[model samples]
Target: MWKSRKSLVELSGNLRLIVSHARYGKANFHGSNTHPHNRIYIVEKTKSPDKSYIANLSASPGQKVILRPGHVYFMPKDQTVEWNFTPGVTFVAFHFGLEIFRGIDLFDGDSEFIERPVSEDFTREARELMESSDDLGHAVRLHGMIYSLSGMFTDKTMKAVEQARELMREYAPIIHYIEEKCDAQTTVAELVDHFGMTRNSLSKGFAQTVGVPLKTFMTRCLLRKVTQQLLTTGLDSKQIAEELGFSSEYYFCRFFKKHTGMTPKAYRSDILH
Candidate 1:
């Protein structure tokens, strides 16, 4: 079922999941009169289209564009677009709310639109699965399709982010050493020796790329580890503190509360409840 703007409730709640697999055989104007709520469209065509457009932008076949089938097209609630469906064009489309795709900075415009062709095999299997199901089975098939489509974008985005993160990964040995010897009160000298860089150069490069002082980042990482332990394990504050290389449980509690605005115990309680 195609949803018009008037009946949208998914955007208000910040996220929604839409799943469908079908063929569009007629020419129709999508989003001609009203904007859909925040949504991502994943469409796979059984037959090739002559042309299509999102808003005023045009898409051609096999361009590695962002919104192609097996990929995602994220758009805000107030944006407008048009689709010119060629006859015999069979496609599966999925819609997701904007919140579901928050923090992904792939598209270059206000509307998160990416259009490119996807692998024919994947598209065929997805379409087949959707076609052979109904109700809950259809829902399951659609969920799987969404999962696959989301992963495609996520993998691409993560690769881009990972390029920026590689410098930090290179410093992983030092970071791990610090975490291990936190009680021994490691110094910058030790990190410098292990990484074979002058203190000044190391600090400058880390700050430029990671946007945090090395010491500050180390402390944050340690604190995060402690927080996870507190939440997931039965360990007390003291045990967590000691494991994270904190000088004392009181100091750890104070540090955690300072950064997180809640005591570790309180945070754990809130999460659990």
Candidate 2:
């Protein structure tokens, strides 16, 4: 449904949201881990009759949030959170990413985790999404559920999102080109030539506007594609490296580990499990 407000339409016109992993069952995770994508959990039961919680080690050494039944909790990407759950806890969990510009995450710099009570309307829609049998219908419902849940956590980032939407408009074509070239092992010099801009201008402009050097953004674009394949496909490291234009499996593993702090195999196993 299209909204009447022009600002709303323009701001969200290029938004991209991907829900990569979702699961529902008894809470079975323990220990600390970092994920490269955003995550949300809807609590159904507590660890005990009391004391249902997870600690955000990134925010502080031992900051904990109490999980209440019917509450939705969000943990930002690339941050470590410690899970202290018992068999009695259960949840519906989704791991997803949201971007306002190509490769630019909406919650890019957020380190704090947040929680809010699930609304009646959202819970009803989630039920419908779970019951849906048609594949396309299920995907649509699932995306809607994630988008709605995302709204609950965006209060801190809303202003930044709006600012980014405005700042990145002039560089949209460059962003899109880099995203398209992500699988090709593209380079900053290639972007300079293709865009017909001098090295200095291209580098300075991109860094100023996007908050990262152009080369850094290119690396992020490649990392995003690599992680997406790792999450969604059965391709092994060698195949992924060959398909994405990496020189070799060893180099690909090094690059992935250098940027993400884990090898592709470990990332896939940790997230999938």
Candidate 3:
């Protein structure tokens, strides 16, 4: 028998979970959209009776991950994955974001696809949790399952969390300000004034440290908010624009098209329909 005298490590950080969507059903999804959130699938049945199932254009160049039944797969954020799912593939999917620091996804810009096999009981438990009428219980169980799945990539997950903490410790205030201002129109000059730094200095430092130009980062933040609202809300473009503090729906549509290469209506039609 093995016994521990005490806990090996105590958790001190709180990871935030933002669940954008969840579903349990058969689906035939095939696309290459680079979404803002990470995704997980607890697959049940595939069209094939053999080992081959979903064809994945994996993160590694010239590599593939053939998703099989009774496995849970984790896909990172901001990476385009070409998926070719067989017809009548059934799974439970969760589209979510995990944040170790506010406004920073732990798996942001990661390209790896992680997978682990699960027992029938585990799959059944997930299905039950998804089908439950109790929202609070469902949320709790869903979080537990996500945490358990994340533990599969223990070293990588911990390293990412630690890196986020270190980065946030230095840039939290500016990041918070950007997040606050991103829902509306934001300007680099405004950031310079608020932070009491020259435009060049702020831009260089932010880009070097954050790996994205300051203005570009702000635009991405705004774009992610716009995309989330478009997917999760039934509001029209005008309503969404007003709610998001855009000056006009015309400008909003223009910005959306400029970044996403599609109008909001077209985006919804292609993605949600």
Candidate 4:
């Protein structure tokens, strides 16, 4: 830990950082509606996995980790990971835009799972101080917490699904095309024609490998793109909706509110604030 209790304001310029303190057990592992935020989680009270929800994009097939107190985990932005947690687990999670650290490279920007060991004493103290600190001070504390795990970054002690890509090798070109045309006025029927496959074949094939139905995956991608615009662009809802290929602005608002708890304008306000 850095000994100086310096102001965190300097380290956190233009950083949109938020922290969540939570306890969970006996929780079903709901898949994440993955977003563009990179995340950091630190364990406070590690308990049973039977009730402890543990899921991530990096966990290998049938691979799982035994949660231990004093461990910290990192999730890269835009990865399809599970955010659910099991019961009796106390943890603090931090989420921020990846671009905030784009120049620093403190954490792995590409890996899905990064774990590091910290002393339980330090973890508990950091959590308490982080919760009590004022906005700027709180950010500094979080930055310090990240620094404690810096050794893991230097050591490369991360476990990612290195082989998962090989399994979906067949859909490599198709997936790339879909992503590039994600906002294009494209439909599944058109996709089927382009690939010379039936709807079920493409959808099922993608689900088999991507863990999400094809249409659902595409919808999530579109919504994520819309979210970025909502946060960063000045385009009105109607214009943004049409650009993303929605049937109408009304439908776009409903879909946006469904995926995100707030309407587009509200979401933008909250983020900007």
Candidate 5:
């Protein structure tokens, strides 16, 4: 189970954010070699020729390295390693618990490594935030910067998700308008005016981009609304059927069963349970 309270090292005093910056001199030291209580490490390289050993793998500056000022590495916890800092190598390290990185899957196994250079502007902002002596202020600023950096990474992964959602948004207004006017007898002809496309063109575009036929998508939207109403409200089957533009309660039950393999009452009970 995940802990609700963060450890002392994970909490920022008065800042509500935990961030630390350190510079290492030429040193080779090994103590407990056990993973510290903290689980995440954000190491930004200011100077290099540093060597890090984790498990059986070792990483150095020259090999498999692309140096940019804003370079960052995310190291997770429970891994043992030795650090050999080439004399006078300066860097900033942020130590936090694994919970902060819960949404990010940076590693593939029990232990993993990540090294990437950050943008110059981002690096400068992080450095300035770290320089603040005010713990609370520093935490807030650092939190924002780290979040921004994390968002940058997330945006890369979600590029396809965003594109799909954008297409959905473009057609959503028309779909919503049709749904609203369903009781008043809306037709596909009305959608042409809203989307400015012929029937074939619109169908093709929606299928190719949205990955669903127009009719099927509309059915999904209507069913989703019906499900929401069923789960949240005390309306009965017949009332919901009329509200959702179904001809009869029996028809609505069949439609719901076909799509979900369960009757409305059964679905609701499953959700509540």
Candidate 6:
């Protein structure tokens, strides 16, 4: 059953679209808050938040992440989600299997990057389009959104998925090694010595399996380490650089700018304020 339409739901018999308009009262929630609808959900946070507004949701037993206002989360259906929300948490949820693009990039995407910051106006428009009785229009809007989001992943950039778990396990020692040495000077030679793999093999194999070069991956780990310091601690750039084994503050700024396209000070200013 093939059809020429921008919307997957409009293709007729390919998929079914279900919309749920729900709200959560500000309360301390525990245990399973399960719903009967077993389909993918595109959740959008409408309305504005006052001070100290935060919500926590878990897709698994031990993993929890925050859900803030203006965050759009594309959640899979299989997750056992427990959510505790701030006062007046409204959700516009779309439920659908999205079977049309069975071979599309969603299957290869990582879950950690699910949430996106959408403008309030965009969320309102999507909510209105979804709430309207026009099914095709709603389907089209949802389809476009999914397409754009999934398009963010490519062969070179997609993160570790379930299928790559064995390889991830195999490289666990190397990842751990990188984690331990990310704050200091790390090189492929030292990594190869520790992991006992040749330079060429390690370089190409890690990139192919992990979707990024080992050097690049270690640099990212370092970036995360430094970024956390920049956010949480009151240490200045020079002190942080010295403690992290950088030769000088100038080199630290260069490294941060090379990786993130912004200096640490600028990033701290933009994020903290």
Candidate that scores best on TM-score: 3
Question: What is the Cα-based TM-score of model 1?
Answer: 0.41
Between candidates 5 and 6, the lDDT winner? 6
Ranking by lDDT: 2, 3, 4, 6, 1, 5
My TM-score estimates for the predictions, one after another, are 0.41, 0.81, 0.82, 0.49, 0.39, 0.46
Candidates by TM-score, descending order: 3, 2, 4, 6, 1, 5
Off by over 4 Å in 3: 1-12, 49-63, 157-160, 247-273
Worst 10 residues of 4 by lDDT: 98-107
Model 3 C-alpha lDDT versus the unseen true structure: 0.75
Prediction 3 TM-score vs. true: 0.82
lDDT for each residue of candidate 3 in 58-156, tens digit (9 for 90 to 100): 455544577788999888765556666767677888778777676777676566777889999999988888788867877888888887776674355
User: lDDT tens string, model 1, 43-89?
Assistant: 55424444544552323321222233454354443234454544443
Residue 122, candidate 5: alpha-carbon lDDT: 62
lDDT (Cα atoms) of all candidates against the true structure: 0.51, 0.79, 0.75, 0.60, 0.49, 0.54
Q: On residues 181-247, what C-alpha lDDT tens digit does candidate 5 reach at each position?
A: 5431335666777768899888887677555576665664565566667766889999998887788
List the candidate 1 regions with Cα displacement exceeding 4 Å: 1-159, 165-184
Question: How much does candidate 6 score in TM-score?
Answer: 0.46
- Model 4 segments beyond 4 Å from truth? 1-160
Output the number of the lDDT-best candidate: 2
Better-scoring candidate (TM-score), 3 or 6: 3
